[model samples]
Target: MFHRYLNKVAVVTGGSKGIGRGIVKVFVENGAKVVFCARGAAEGEALQAELNQSAAGSCSFLSCDVSQEEDIKRLIAHTVTLHGHIDCLVNNAGWHPPHKATDDTTADEFRDLLNLNLVSYFLASKYALPYLRQRHGNIINISSLVGTIGQKDAATYVATKGAILSMTKAMAVDESRYYVRVNSISPGNVMSPLWLDLAAQTGAAAEAIKAGESNQLMGRMGTEDECGLAALYLASEATFCTGVDLLLSGGAELNYGFKSQICS
Candidate 1:
């Protein structure tokens, strides 16, 4: 087992499933004691147990609804109380609601998404910064490829993700004095439960999935494990990296025109 992160302590939000879960798994596999949380207790507990069985490090689960300020605060405080220090803070808790045009999206929906997808990141970092400063730890915010290049009919989701990227840069600057790095990963077409759900939402699920796969120049969607590896790189290596938005898009944004036109 790799001991790259042995004895390190990491706090991951929304780690019960999807990309967040992948990040937690990678950290534990690399020997980082991880404290992860999600809104679903059953899933979180199951993941905690599964990882602890064979992980080089160890992990624990906490029930947290990241949309709530208290929950974010409690998650960070509980991790520090349990481990005494934080080596990494992965603000991965977020959601991408069904696609909606700007005219169709309600103000309340936008605000709700902001609270869950953007504000939670801020609150988690605000609470974890003190502990991270002591250990010179870093932060990895899970953003989206759409955040950089806009997505059609997904204005609300894009807004939140774009904000996260900006916030990551600002925080990176502010935290440099304490040696606490901040970075973001903008993933494109990652095949996770969330992505599957989004695909299924379309009337033609199979076609939607195929189109998503074709969007990437690689002609396939990315995997959760890939996201995990990227997070590991940011946390364990990439020492000189801060205020950077790493794109995990499988080269989806490389060319300008339709995939058929570009490839053909």
Candidate 2:
């Protein structure tokens, strides 16, 4: 029902599935000519075909590993070549490694995750900022509730997310001179394939999945679709908003007591 994105050109990373997939679907439905990337060509291509089949807007998928500078450059260049300009950039590609004590994680491992989760955002922004400035476009970084409140046994993950939140603010100020808006979305717990994979890895997928609902005060985890709508708002509307970390925590960020204890 949102018509704000008609003919807009957007670039989303990790668009094959889960939160990224939801964002792609919503943007295309709203009328964006979206170019989204995933490391795997099969899934990305499949999604592109599917979305282009029925969506009001068009979709094109490119194979990319956001961690690599070359790939990031290629993505932006290819998008501009096809769309002529970028109206929005959604940095949604990232992975959450299994939780481990800081002392248990290695320097190399930490750096690797940082390259994918943190550095990629910076690189993408750097490469697209000029075009974005021209269009007065926006950037939406997909942060997490942990970035705001912190999470145990996830020092590196939390650190990267915290950096993302901070970088969003810093970049917003720097980019504002050109009228480019930058912001972030800190999701609490969206029940996506990533969460399901983690639960399965714990060998208690059913129980752990059920417990996730209770972790939120609402007795349910947030959905990818809900996260999608939030991104849509920031991307299409929210003209006056910038440098803000919008929390989509389903009240988890505000609630205290057992819900807080169990969730965190």
lDDT of each: 0.92, 0.92
TM-score for model 1? 0.96
**Candidate 2's C-alpha lDDT?**
0.92
Lowest summed lDDT over 10 consecutive residues: which window, candidate 2?
Answer: 255-264
> Residues 1-264, candidate 2, lDDT per residue (tens digit)?
657699999999999988999999989989999999999898889989998998889999999999999999999999999999999999999989987888899999999999999999999999999999999999999989999888878899999999999999999999999999999999988888888888898888999888777778788998878888899999988999999999998788774654344654
Q: Per-residue lDDT tens digits of candidate 1, residues 1-264?
A: 457788999999989999999999988999999999988899999999999998899999999899999988888889878999999999998999998878888999999999999999999999999999999999999999999998888999999999999999999999999999999999999988898899899988899999999999999998888999999999999999999999999999987865242453
lDDT of 2 at 37: 97
